[model samples]
Target: MDTCALFHRYWALASESGYGDDLSGQIRRSHGRRPQHGSTANVYHGTFIPNGLEVAIKTFPSTLSGMGDGSEVLAGLKCIFREVHIWSKLRHENIVPMLGMSKDFECTISVISAWMPMGNAYDYVQNTNNDPRPLLRDIASGLGYLHGHELGPVVHGDLKGLNVLVSSDRRALLTDFGLASMNTSTFNMTVEAIRGGSYQWMAPELLDNCVATTESDVWAFGMTALELFTRAVPFPDCHSVANVVGSLILGRLPPRPTQESTQFRLTSTWWEICTSCWRRDPSRRPTVDEIAERVGRAMYDTAPASFTASSHAYAPTMDTMQSRLSFTGDGPRSAPITDNDNLLPCATLSGLADKILSLSFSPDGTQIASGSANGLICHWDVHRRAQVGPLSRGHQHWVRSVAFSPNGQWIASASYDGTVRTWDVHNGVQIGSSLQGHQGKVFSVAISPTGGGIASGSADKTIGLWDVQAGKQVCALVGHTDKVQSVSASQSRIFVSGSHDKTVRLWDARAREPVGRPFEGHTGMVWSVVFSPDGRQVVSSSQDGCLCVWDVRNSSRVRHRLEGHTDEVTSVAFSPCGRRLVSGSMDSNVFVWDAQSGARVGASLRGNAGWVRCVAFSPDDGRQIISGTEGGSICIWNERIH
Candidate 1:
């Protein structure tokens, strides 16, 4: 129908229904006595003058009618037209049915619906003694109907606790559609108005790029469910909008509530469903139908025991006497392990004089290079599980980072002696003079995928780029306010650096400048950083005992936030297939995680005598994980162990 005809039809219906009476007087005499303010409209309790049937009158803001030109006013009218057209046709039990539209309110137009005495879903759950599972199921059912409409699917751009109202019968009904979109036609609303969603409940994709889809709505549903159960806003720890944006950019979901009463506790199955809805990949999220079915089943079943509590029940003690360890394995490059998999003792290579601080695997995966506190670099054979060559020594202080060349011919080491040097791996001799540019101690170094460029991060708050073939400093990029702790270079010559400033910055080696905004999620100093196999993602470890996986292509989107370590996470490395990650921590534990799901793979690998300082995955097969400890021991684990 045309816009003018639709408006006249609704206006005629309102006139016949006697909606022209003053709503303010009717609201003052009604049960609510005051108007309720929402993001898009103001709702007041009122009554139909003819039959005295109670109803709610929703009026748009008058500012929308006072734009610079008349075009904006016309657009506002068209928006109301579209919303009324869509909302009036919806007939599901969980959907708030539209009664009529009126022009007698303060704004140019108004919408009327059935009066919900129980208020919004958030208030209802907080004030009543009703079971939240039935409300959650009602919400899912309403969303499912909108998405599965036979005419054309509709996307509820805003799905949160505030948008759902509870009826007198305790049924949750979805209300506002100001930000919704219909597949048949587009609304004439401004971009700012359309993107006006609650930031805490928004999906990462929507926060990164302000485009809302059905998948994004699913993400909001998960946050809404969390709000109902916790009786608080999403991400309750975040204090402001900036903090919420930062958390969402880092793919950090709300941590499970620890103090919830037994009546409101979230079961393991329900939490799993919520996490599945918040997956980083939009296609991986479950459909509304699936969510409704899960909630329905959950309502009738007994609450299961906590899965997180049982996963960390056993902690192994340190054992240093074993020289060689073996385990039953499926094969090389087997599927990623699960929490049920058993962890066995692994081979231990000992002989270093002082603390082992750094580790790296050769491209062929046969040889491993490690740097120690006494400035000694040693090479080891994986199969033989012993030292391979004479120790290479030159630095005057502790060696902090080591990386192998692409061809496995040279090893680059960064030291606290304020220099970076390359050593010939085969003969244990220095390749060239030390590359000196930083005024402070160098903490980390990485070789580019092509093996021609080297990036070094130092305590001087600068990153030095060096030419490996020329053995000279190319340029120094300075931006960090604090010390740079770790650096990793990708195949495209682009690199990422984590700093003591508690931020992660991306740099283009060729351009010699920053790429985008610094990733700002970690609350503690960043300790380590590394790029995934495809160079599309970067995983960073921090002193906060957490790991964040970021999408390199878009700095605003973080793929996951891994939280299991009990102490400072010292190092992180991606497997060859990019499906798994290994991290070492000061807690003297090593953990393996599913890179995609951000779920802990199995029990923590224990037995390190002291703090774990470095970790790496085999470059060739990804089956072997090597970790070095402060007590001068290197352990190799087979992740495919049965």
Candidate 2:
């Protein structure tokens, strides 16, 4: 029979039998060698018949007869097809380019892609003298492209050294999209099927929730970096998967390699980057862009061989080593501010049991209240730089937010326990029973300027108006379609709420209804919101890494779009004078911006050991800026006017 006729016959037979053995045979395996085995698929070195070019043919086990139940086989086929569809659309130098596909392979399908002669990252790095920094940079660049794709962010469900292939030119290209997920409708794999990946590289949250996200991918990237550096899997000491899972659950990351290697040494700076990616809170994990920048800088700024295990031996440039001393006790408690244009580190406040998630200054600015992941709220005397009273403890879960009442006598705290509570600042004790109305975790709380009322945003997608004196919920303001992340009350009766739905809404407390059309501009979840000192404008920070200033009087009008942060802007606030804005981000840096022109005021303020969760300007005069970080320490900075 003719070649075209033979191809048609094989296609028909494969479709009928749910097998593609005849079609797959067209790509002859190189010397009939055994295929390289993987968790989901086996890759065979082969030559494409049509193009007469070398290629890698990846086949799944489900393509074979009797591999599993009919439904299971069907799911496997769907996953393979989904991967092909997604991979075909991606085009990047560091990402493996798709060639073609063989249909009905043995009863499933096979993916064809460019063959990498040098093999995977782990094997290549182990056998060759090639510096791994370039390969690491390639991986980061590829991952960043996938995340920042124009269509939608694609999450590589599994990222490990094995999935990174090195071409003949020693360029690392990311492969294995079988477990990837995209925001588009092309992804149809069941959560259970796609959730399973290499355990040692998985994020802690993924083990419990079984949901793969970009943040989880970042976690895996950190593990992949470890693998490339050590030439072994993550947690090499753990003999079994259960041990690795347990360690990750307890927030234990892979220990830093003590022994230095001639091939590549893991410096303290690189170790810091890896740990940042492994932060317990996924939202606090550094973005791929930030990772790429750091890795790129390290590649160019310092030679790998020059680094030593001793923290003091390697001295990176000031620009590269933005802040080697962390407030988390890694070094000196406070470092002198090196740049005149940046905020000067004046004091470092420590003692929180866990990461500080929220912070609020007293009306007089003499005291500060901080909420922690350990469910405790601590009061600090700003001048004394010490805890003022006993820790306030009532919430059973994470304290997400805290706010001081206008009178400076009471502090309102919102928690993940689905409750908001009031505490007496003087005694640091819960004043009443937990105020419970929301059906979900309360993320933020703001007291009215008069201190008589309180507003709270919750995961329930509803804003609660609470009567502080009565200690009860007054009404539920419903409008948001997703989790309400933040809420702020203006001097008037106006209140603003930002939600995961990617919109900001204004509410009139007196009427208990929305004031105008939702202020819509952000493309990601709104993480924080606050009103200007005059209450005429609203400032919001979002996961999109941009802040929006909305005119309260004209809700639909966005006054300014401030963009500088390279990662999720976790929190933002206006200076007491309302002339400037301060923002903290998962990038571990704080920035000051001109409130009027939406321009960055000075260099990024750096020192936080982890994600900066909350930033606030002193209500007294805005001369001091305090930022709380996921490292469980607070940094007080003197704002130097440029």
Candidate 3:
């Protein structure tokens, strides 16, 4: 309602530099500072002497001006309306003010706003000796006003420390509405608009569905509070954006800064508000008004005298803050240093034919089950390092994936023959009739945490949830537009899938429906996806020659992208403790990466003689890494950090 009125008032002066009547000398970029990238535009520093206004100019790149003349450039036009019309009407001390806009004949749109010389809140906290209590209060006030504005409840789709600018007076003003969506209950942006920036501050629902609400804003506010206190990004414990999303989806909260770092002594009252704002159920999260009240009380309880409402007669100088500040840029923190050495082959089992598609260790750590290219399923005794029995008969085509049931009593296998089969572990005998329904190759299979359902992802671009006991399809999940490559069932009812579509998706076992928006980031086909032992994160291998760790709770963001393999990453698995990750690739190497930091734990394991098709961690601990090569030789490497 509020946005429409602003759009109507400025319709006559659309795309004109004099629309706001604040136009001054031609703004020129002279010694511009580092730019802050958004989904649509980049904000750069510029000065316009016409009004003596030191401002930041957000310029929309012409590339997004869709091909064709005038009207065809809908994206560019919408961005203009958002900044010049909607944002310009918003007037509040806590909200960044839009001064003017200019659109050239070349289709470049630029929106100018008064710049805050003190920098962003993140930098202020990092570089200044100033207390963050006032900044936090200012941020809360700004967010509250935006959510309850007289015009409309504008959902600031992207809220983080960088978007919260610090004025010369040490006040936080909410800025950057490039991702803002107005008058909509659910905000959905295109996939191209999803890149750039860490998603640590996004709410779970917003990450999963691209749907941002006022409640979601409250969630992000909580994250910003954590950032203020920690002087680090929210979910700093996570190694990647993918991991952060997984953690949120699984209801995992970021660790308290006080517990993890010695930077600040975070009080209990502040922590309480932070956790309350992160409640998984959006309905349970505190409203922005309620949050503002609580933050005010926290500030009062902590320091009452530091916060006083008034405008100084002269513009404040950046004396104390900028003098101590120094930074190149911001990104996901690096992994802690750990052991880095190539794993040596301790043993090798050689007997099978061509490529080994899948492998898994028994739950008890005594045995391993592997599916081969020729549809042969074999079992091995770990201690003896030998096959327990002869290869068993199964699917007519290649067996693409294999998994041991939670109880370790059965093994599930998916094959190119378009069927799923279960086999008893103790005896090489089929458990029941073939589970059929898929119209294309069944590439991956996973046993549910409850051991009740067996999930399979197939070339049909559908997911099948089958009842393990009945051996029948329960329901079909149709979401991925390309072939489904991998499936992993979390300890809970949630299951995740990777696809040739270059996306990962989450599904609820009980609801038989998709959970949230697809986790879209990979540029190549996703070959494998598996959940961590705790179900807080997911690891996926892709044809793009990298391993991606995604946060299961926050389904839309990729937390980490581990690159090193020379070719496609074929398989990925988590250690028993969920602290380490092992991946095999077409490069004939097996690599281990730290689950927390997304850092490669050690050098690539290099004893294999051919392309490494599959890898599995020993169920006992991560002491041993087992990998099966294209030539059907299973190499066992010791994973001790040396």
TM-score winner: 2
Write one digit per residue (lDDT tens) for candidate 1, span 1-642: 244454455455544544333233333225547888865577888876654556888887652445444555555665666676667667787899777766666635677788886689988667323446667877998999999987688888889988999864356999998778767643333333356588988999887666688999999999998888877889888999999999988878888775355244467777877898999999999999998777754542332122121244332222222222222352112123223212111111222134578999999999888887667787877765555665687898778899999999999999989999999998889997999989998999999989999999998899999999898999999888778999998878799999978899999999999999999889888999999989889999998899999988778867799999877898999999999898998777788898999998878776324557888988887878878865456766655443
Lowest summed lDDT over 10 consecutive residues: which window, candidate 3? 316-325
Candidate 3 lDDT score relative to the true structure: 0.71
lDDT of 2 by residue, 1-642 (tens): 133343344345434543222345567667767789976788888887764557898887544355566555555555666677678778887899887667535544677788886689988777433446667888998999999988799998989998999864346999998888788644334434467789999999888866799999999999998888788898988999889988987888777886465243567777888899999999999999999877754542233121111122221111111122235534233333233122212122332135678999998999889887668887876775655666687888778999999989999999989999999988778888889999988999999989999999998899999998898999999999888999998889999999988999999999988988999999988999999999888999998999999888887678999998877898999998999899998777788888999988756766524458899999989888888765445767765432
The per-prediction tally of clashing pairs is 0, 5, 19
**Candidate 1: deviation at residue 481, Å?**
1.0
Clashes of 2: 5
Q: Compared with the true structure, what per-residue lDDT tens digits does model 3 show for residues 259-346?
A: 3342333578889999999998899999988887776555423211111212333111110000011112331111221122111111
Superpose all Cα atoms of candidate 1 onto the true structure and report the RMSD in Å to 1 decimal: 23.7
Stretches off by above 4 angstroms in model 3 are 1-352
The Cα local distance difference test for each model comes to 0.76, 0.77, 0.71
RMSD to true structure for each model, in Å:
23.7, 16.3, 25.8
TM-score of 2: 0.55
Off by over 4 Å in 2: 1-352
TM-score, every prediction = 0.47, 0.55, 0.46
